[model samples]
Target: MGLFGKLFAGPQVDMAKSDANRKKMRELFNEVVENGQDYKLIFGFTEDIGWFNYGFVHGSKTKIGNLIVGWNDNSQTIVVVPTVPDLSGCGDATFYRRNEIRKAYQSKYPTDAFIIYPDRKGYIGINVCDWLEDEKLYVYVSQEEEVKEFTDFFLKRFQTK
Candidate 1:
């Protein structure tokens, strides 16, 4: 390859490493979901929406990381758990409830945001402007089947008609 080609070439990714990481994430997610039978478990990724130009321009969503959420109707609590691929292990879970959440909706842009349930604090991210008042959680699931399952289980229990 020429110098120009090397300079202009997009960032290269190690597919093998990415695949291994994905596999590890899946394994962790499965284990968490299996043990969380009492609560409705959903697998997905989270995003942080950034702001620029005094809120005039909304930057593209920045992927925070992947997670597996478990919510229990009886307890009226929701837990956001992380799925890390590294040897360091996963982080602690953040808990929320109906009172904390302001709104819940299925995002039209599935790739960006699938199911969003933003709480009173709204979207939490670095340099994020809370454009919407009282919005909370954000979840994005790529698979259609999993999305459907999550929607059915979550909305049915959490949201009121």
Candidate 2:
């Protein structure tokens, strides 16, 4: 190793891990397509990791590919966290409530960005942009692999069913 290289930090081997994460995210997103009726979503690691920064509550199991949603009556425009989290009302109408859950989960990882796609009823759809805030994927991606990542994350969860 060069003198300067040894003195400073080394290369990041975590890139592989990030790619794996992206793939999983794609899987999860596709799985949610069938039941996108009412599923709010968020993009906080806490949502999936299950923990709150406030320490009041913990253990939030994200529905794999759901978006974190919220409503602001005063604004009358539906303010969402990280990204907008509306519902589609595909399966359960509880998507509205799910939005709340996303917010609750976001307490811990505030910077964990996510993308919420809502249907006509202002219902959120899937995590179209779960990795948007990821530093690894700072640039826009339009490759087939990107889609696969979301699909994998969504479908994998439904395998048990």
Candidate 3:
């Protein structure tokens, strides 16, 4: 490979590293949540929202790293964790107990509250409403099955309420 080849090559995405990171994230989630095996794990990415110049921008799609969501139907709890590809940038997993969430819904359009994040595009937007001092947890997933799984879980739990 010459200098031209190096320059022409696009960003190198290490799928193996990404997979390992996802696994590590699941392990971390299990460590925090009780009866982790009972929870359904949904893999996705957390949008890194930021301000540029005078308005919000998409920034990098996966700059914040992978996102793993653990949902337990029996316990009525949800755990959200963000894991970096290298595992060093991992943060504390957020837990949403049964009584903690006041409401939840899916937003087709990105609201002002979530405008800073990436556009909804073709991804599914799940808004976990009124949890952790009114903080909103917005998760965007690209896969069709993942979208169905997440929406089904939340809609069944919160929509009727």
Candidate 4:
């Protein structure tokens, strides 16, 4: 490596690993389509509280894929993806409850940059441009009859189904 490259580079990110993770995220998203009416598309990783703490709560952007999957105890899985996919430079998941989870998971997974949060209400708000329109996505699973609700929502809103 060049002296400048060596000196200026902050910790080197494993591109291969990142790509694999991204691929998995994409595949899971496709799974949502294939499964149809069985899964809800959430916004953040809600597989577990710890994963949520790492990926969403901590504000760590993977730069891999803009999605994650979570399954409820009853075998209901929700695939979470962002419509405003580019969250590279600036991104944030705001909320008190999320903040609390992020703080607690910090020590548990100190070096871990991203962990998938499952089965929780996660939302992402984006302001594209002043002239353009703003978009917001809220990913969650309802306790009531959510299959039809989520399926219809995904199909009508995102046109992905």
- Best of the candidates, TM-score: 3
The global C-alpha lDDT for each of the candidates, from Candidate 1 onward, is: 0.50, 0.33, 0.51, 0.32
- Cα displacement (angstroms), candidate 1, residue 136, comes to 27
Model 2: lDDT equals 0.33
TM, every model: 0.48, 0.26, 0.53, 0.26
The candidate 3 region of ten consecutive residues with least summed lDDT is: 129-138
Per-residue lDDT value at 127 in model 2:
33
Which stretches of candidate 3 lie above 4 Å from their native place?
1-23, 54-65, 86-89, 111-144
**Candidate 2's error at 76, in angstroms?**
13
Q: Can you write out model 2's per-residue Cα lDDT over 46-155, one digit (the tens) per residue?
A: 13445455566555554333333322222222223231122222222123222232322111134423333333333333333424433432322223453454344433
Residue-pair clashes per prediction, in order, are 7, 34, 0, 10
Regions of model 1 farther than 4 Å from truth? 1-37, 49-61, 85-88, 109-119, 124-146
Per lDDT, the best of the predicted structures is 3
Tens digit of lDDT per residue, candidate 4, span 1-161?
A: 89999999865545564444344444545544444344433333222222225544553333322334322223423333332333222122222222133221111232312232322664322111101111123222121233345333423333211
lDDT of 1 by residue, 42-128 (tens): 545566556556567655655456465666767776667675424134556666666766665444453434343455655421111
Candidate 2 backbone overlaps, count: 34
